[model samples]
Target: MSNKSSLNLEAINDFIVNWLKSYAENAKVKGFVVGISGGIDSALTSTLCAQTGFPTLCVEMPIHQAESHVNRANEHIDQLKARFSNVFNERVDLTPVFEMFKNQVSTSDNEAVLNLTLANTRARLRMTTLYYLGGLHGFLVVGTGNKIEDFGVGFYTKYGDGGVDISPIADLMKSEVRQLAAYLQVPDSILKAKPTDGLFGDDRSDEDQLGASYDELEWAMLEVEKGKKPEDFEGRKAEVLKIYKRLNSSNQHKMQAIPVCLLPDKLKLL
Candidate 1:
């Protein structure tokens, strides 16, 4: 991982913008559709897509969302549309749809499981909505996941936020995402706001859920990448390393391709 100060922000920005343009051209898609969560990642992704001179749709799907989250999302979208002629936004209030979904599903006695399942349902609903809009407009569903969440800890909902046609920032660490976002002139509110999935409809943050800050997680991820073991650290460093390893191991199913049981060619012929 490169230090934020050392990253070539200009080069990175140009590369991503060109990559997005080329990919969209190759796929024969008109543009991109991104889900905006009032977070830094989405803000940056939409900005990059807009820089490609393609139509960038920023969709806000709120399902019993926090006022702060909704406000920030709107703030970013307004700023984006002001800056780029190609940027457009849509707000889809999914609270009623979510309530209807709960009405149709079985309830669980376990509070933790029920809460997690519902939170994930919120994400999947947003995913489906993005795809729906994309299908209508011949656009690709842009993903907002950064490298750490997409691969390191896999802290995203599988097939929810994880579902997308492309991920623009999946190679950048969270710190790097913030740095690049800053360079791209993303709203300061989003850059400074604590990171969250906004799935729980509460004020809980990504750190509150992950048990470690992104900076700490990034360090742990780099150490593990360099073949360092938990035994090589002490105190908080060791604890963070353990947390990173646990998440990375458990979320392998989300990070890897779906498993396939291969049978012999002869069996297939029979």
Candidate 2:
């Protein structure tokens, strides 16, 4: 990381906004669909999309028992629409879907994997709506993972919050995102709010799930990104190893090439 006081933020924002617009044009999408949660990541993503001048459709997909989150989501959607030319809010209640899954699965709250699965289900449901409506509106889904979350440990729901066509900010660290947000003049409230994904209730934050701050994670991720050996980060060695194992094991497919079974019938190749 460079000196915090002398970062070139304007160039970062310009690069992201330009790349976003070019990605939309190349993909033949009319716009981009972003799930705005009134949080910094979504707000920054929405602002970048709007800066591109292409249509950005914001959706609020709330499951049951999340009134507070629903209200916050609506607030951001309204604000986003006011400044953007083609911003609209679409609602798709996922209570029934969640209920169906809960009834069918034998999940216990004491089990971490079970709890994670439930949260991931919600993420996937929201992603499904975004992609569906994206197809209908001739747009693509915009993801909100930063570099720390996108790489290193992959702190995202595999194939769930991962339905993105073009990632404009995946290479950015959280600190870098803050700088870019400042350059874009994003609201102070969003910039200062604690980071969260709103997967369960308004109270659920990413820090709570990770047991550490984004800044701490960013250091470890940056080390890994720079090709540091797993054993080198002494104090963070075990912690980073745990995260690397989970992400690599769980998202094996995301990192691997598509498999094609080799057989006698398919042996002939040019």
Candidate 3:
């Protein structure tokens, strides 16, 4: 969304390298625990963390019921398994977890809530695995989310995909994610692929879930960046604001740090 001109990804990578170094040193974190879903987002994120010298632990979490997509997801993991030095690649089948939570929980009359609940379950399950790894090695979880998918459409599950110690690429739009993927020389299979949560039907993708493509989301975000509303664009006004609220409202908490009231002595000697 920060203009269509290509970015100097070397500078981007350099900035992240310093950020990662400072973050780990200050936080005293052992390393990074990354969830690699064989998707472009995860692949690009993992590659960035690894290239920047973090000992990234990449996990492939999938529900056994969705075995086919799981297999497809592993291909992305396999590529990284061959690259990172201290990578931990494991496939934890989440079928039992999903089944247990699904059976014990009673749904309300709302179908939308039901679907969202299931998706959140999948997301939380993945986060559980990531956190487990983080606990084992004192690593911090690295988020794979990008601006367009989670930030633009409010598509991620709160407290689910929202759980992370740090996000290396949360500021990036979906198109910019692909651009970084290209910069990292990520495989073409992932570079040009559709983005999906792998929580719903195998056919469902991010664009379909959001009712708009990355191109549309990018246009809308750019318009917002220029302090213009959807009405300024003529026919797309309604659609633009609809997404504007989604992008703006849904990501409110994600864009901020939790409130920690300053103590009286906190500013004593700054």
- Look at candidate 2 and tell me the lDDT of residue 256: 56
Ranking by TM-score: 1, 3, 2
Identify the candidate with maximal TM-score: 1
Residues 1-270, candidate 3, lDDT per residue (tens digit)? 334667888898778768887898899888888887767888888887787576778787776434545655676667766876756576677788888988897878898888777888889888888898899889999888887656666667777778888988888877777887888878777776677777774668877777777777777877777787766666655586567667667667755678797878866868
Task: Tell me the deviation in Å of residue 193 in model 2.
Answer: 2.1
How accurate locally is residue 174 in candidate 2, as Cα lDDT from 0 to 100?
81
Which stretches of model 3 miss by more than 4 angstroms? 1-3, 64-68, 250-270
Q: Which stretches of candidate 1 lie over 4 Å from their true place?
A: 1-5
The clash count of every prediction, one per candidate, is 0, 0, 0
TM-scores for all predictions: 0.98, 0.83, 0.86
How would the candidate models be sorted by lDDT, starting from the highest? 1, 3, 2
Best by lDDT: 1
* Pairs with steric clashes in candidate 2: none
Residue 133's lDDT in candidate 2: 91
Which tens-of-lDDT digit does each residue in 108-181 have in candidate 1?
Answer: 99999999999999999999999999999999999999999999999999989999999999999999898899
